[model samples]
Target: MSSDRTLLMRPSPAARESLSALTPILHRVVERIGETNDITTLALEPLEPPSMNFRCGQFNMLSALGVGEIAISMSSAPHERMLRHSIRDVGAVSHALCQSSVGDLVGVRGPFGSDWRVESARGDVDQRDTVVVAGGIGLAPLRGAVEELVRDTQRGGGRIFILVGAREPSQIVFRADLESWKARGAKVSLTVDLATSEWDGRVGLVTTLLADAGFDATNSRAMLCGPEVMMRFTARALIDLGMDPEGILVSLERNMQCGVGWCGHCQLGPLLLCRDGPVVPYAGLVSQLLTQRER
Candidate 1:
């Protein structure tokens, strides 16, 4: 079997092309949707038609011209024509992105990294269950996968369950999408660490919702995106509930400068997160996830 390091070092040909080109493709922000007080979703249209189509879990390096660039995951589905990124005003570049107007031009570098591979999770049977867990803004990365999963479930595929956690009700990002997913037949549950007077749902850690989530652990695949601590505990919780560690996946974040393996900034243990993953199986990350300090 190839080691994780070896596997990560060998990126797909498309990724190699993206990494080789340092030039940014200019894209215009066609629309902006405010999700919360500090988070906004930008829909970008390339000046020319894009040459590549991004997959779920892939990230793009979005540049705010003079400000800087940041790696943001695509919140739009793979089939969409416009590239959508949900940005939070946590840093200078992100703040710039959040404040962008409908006609603003942004530089885009890639649709890089390993993907969630949601299509394969159901195998040939197409009846396997899928569970998605997102915390805070982490939902931005997993939104594409959830969208695909929802469509799959509608076509005689397995059941879909979405579990979300936020700091408060107002902190939740895809509010309307959550309602649409539930309306479309997904079993959706939400919880927050704190509650406002307007909130009437569950208030606790997202992990608590797992107990009541209905899924056959023997034939289920779980994907999680959140703070590292939250992912660590949630992955462990899923395992304790009889899910295989190998069947669980997590998306990680790091100080990524270059959106390729050439720069060593995003290394996590033996993996260069930019090339190897933002999304990876829990089985391959057990050692690193358990021992590595948060970056």
Candidate 2:
């Protein structure tokens, strides 16, 4: 990563030990929320006291017994007691997880990978702005960071701007949280690729909103999560506006079969996303992002 970027947090000793073991800690699903037609949020309670401590942008390996396991981002804030994962039913494992009922046992391992390190965005002066860009279900991974940013802004730290884009108004996840964040003073903007008759929001690529967004490009930090194509374009747009590439971060997704680095399934260029990233500075990924074919 770039010298200007914050170092990725290493897993704690307890997390490291947990990674060495393959067995998952079983948790019971306490609540299931339908965020959209395809996306669902599962709130889990540990069978024992919670020992896993995760930062924003970290992910957990969730297993649906007799099916398979998949990587899901933590959609709830770290300060929250229950563990929440927003899953999109894209495959067998995810579908099984989404179909899980209350009181069902789900296997969970790891609060792994790198983190968003939102605190670093506030430099010595602590007045730097935070710009968050999300596309489709990408908002799920960024929820924790957004919650922290909102609280910081409430404490009179700095400004926060959230720019989100989805396929349509109906596909927007965390609809209630978006309203609450806006009401709590974060500058929130919504856009869609397609619109309905009742829709009144902007209709265009999320990058288009950057021009009118009130933030200091030179001093602000940006965090983006979305499809590879969307993130590529958004990162480039931020660079064109004078933000340092090191100040821009992106969350990547891959076929992460193993939460540890032992498996090479999730390699992206020189980094193993399962261990080295999920969150990484854009400066280090520029070449790879430009050349690698999207999966």
TM-score of 2: 0.90
Per-candidate alpha-carbon RMSD to the true structure: 7.5, 7.7
Q: All candidates' lDDT scores?
A: 0.85, 0.85
Q: State every prediction's TM-score relative to the real structure.
A: 0.90, 0.90
Which residue runs of candidate 1 sit more than 4 Å off their true CA positions? 1-21, 121-125
- Summarize candidate 2's per-residue lDDT along 37-129 as a digit string, tens digits: 999999998666644688999999898977988889999988887789999999899999999999988878888899988675444324679
lDDT string, candidate 1, 1-295, tens digits: 1355334333455565554346666678999999999999999987655444888999999888779989999999987767899999999999999999998878788878988887774454257798899999999999998888888887777898999999999999898999999999999999999999999999999999998898887788899998888899888888888888888888888988888799899988888999989888898555365558756
Lowest summed lDDT across 10 adjacent residues in model 2 is found at 1-10
Q: How accurate is candidate 2 locally (lDDT)?
A: 0.85
Model 1: per-residue Cα lDDT at residue 121: 48
In model 2, residue pairs whose N, Cα or C atoms come closer than 3 Å (at least 3 residues apart or on different chains), thus clashing, are none
Ten-residue stretch with the least lDDT total in model 1: 1-10
- Misplaced by over 4 Å in model 2 are 1-21, 121-126
